[model samples]
Target: MIHQGRLKEDSLMVMKIVGDAICANENQLRRYLSKRQSASKTSSTLKSLRKYGFVERHKSHLAFEEDDEISYKPPAPFTLGIGGYKLMNHLYPEHSFTQPEQWSKNSLAIQRYVAMNEMRCLSVEAGVLRGWSWNPYIGGSAKYRSPLAVAKLESPQGEIQLLMERPQMAQNFIGYYRTKLEVYRYLYERDKYFKIDGFSKANLQIVCLYVSSSSMAKFIQEEIRLHTFPFDIWLLSNEWISEEKGMSEAFCTVNQDGLKRIRIPFLAPKQM
Candidate 1:
């Protein structure tokens, strides 16, 4: 019971920050970071990353001893805290953060607000979004997941870094989630629109949808339940894909224009 929750950018950074400190845990991580989120939110933020088993929680206390037995380093040249700083300084002489002599009162003269904004763009929050994009990412000739429409960039700095990507798709499923009624309304409306497009045989269309739709995920989950109907439906959105699992067996789709754009958010909901 590490009390894991969805890992947001800042939360992930908090984990990295506190995790790298002399001795820190979720409790200590909170005490050191100031944010506008709630108490429970702060607690649950650690849950999702447990998927990767990145952090471990103890029943009584959190212990951090650099275990020689463990091989838990992030991908190449990536380190979290002071190690990150030192690594970046050595790797990037021109932009090395360690040398203040290289910095000037007027060097990169940017307003505090502007500088902060730039920092935010390169922060853990932004990086998580980039990593979690619902965007189509197909890698390797045979891989179906297309590359992200807008990719994330990681810039190493002294104990800091950035993740580049779009924001909406990775939104927290809190107040951001639509009400059940609202979701249904949106579903009906979008379904109507798609029906029209299907009947119209439109060459292309732009459909605005989000990837957090449970109905969509449900459809994918029930891919086994997909039954062939006389009619066929295809999703065609570049950025959004509704991955329904059972649908693969029930129906067939055509990859059009180097895009198998699926309206990934429009699957039928579970039967309650």
Candidate 2:
């Protein structure tokens, strides 16, 4: 007798992480998986999950081999397929799973998130960040505007709210860029308050950490510098995932003061 409960628990943690991040690649999965497990076992388990239609992969392929006959190369990212969504509905009925259709359209967005999760995993290993919080407003109405994602990283210094965004890169880049800057400027200069939940406000150091193509990053940096925006913002390139140096080298932030490189233990995380 195959117990569905047991099957669900077999890779429950993996599902939670995938569902939370919207998607993740195998490399990111290994960080949260049990270190004692062998690589072969991990690959086999993932294969079985795919066979059962619990998870589906994105079009992009990673540069690695998974000891599987199904494909010569493994997929880059994986998300909850129809079956996986059903499992989630069974586990948490309070949440709705009626709209799995939208997940496919957001593949590019998921790619950016997968990269951010990789950075999150690295931060955990470096002992700089204890944990992070994914914005809870997803798939729901937001009372106020919010970042594409908000990661609250807790460190000994203090907590820092990393506003994650992957804005569209189009020919009329300036138009899109100005809209985002204006929104942040309003949040910074006008509101002067931070609210995570309905009630209560805790003023914390908020920094915009955007991930985009190198060309876009350069243009955005120039825009911020040329205009001399008063709010604090950071520009991260897609190459951030392949960076061999520390986080310090991976990003640069701009403000009225000037442009500067940013690292973890990010400049006293007190209320700004």
- Judging by TM-score against the true structure, name the best candidate: 2
Tell me the deviation in Å of residue 266 in model 2.
8.4
TM-score of every candidate: 0.20, 0.74
Candidate 1 lands at a TM-score of 0.20
Candidate 1: RMSD to truth? 20.7
Off by over 4 Å in 1: 1-8, 59-272
Which stretch of 10 consecutive residues in model 2 shows the poorest summed lDDT? 62-71
Give lDDT tens digits, candidate 2, residues 84-162: 7888878878754423566566544555567677666656545456445555342123754556556656555566666
What overall lDDT, based on C-alpha atoms, would model 1 receive against the true structure? Answer: 0.29
Indicate which candidate wins on lDDT: 2
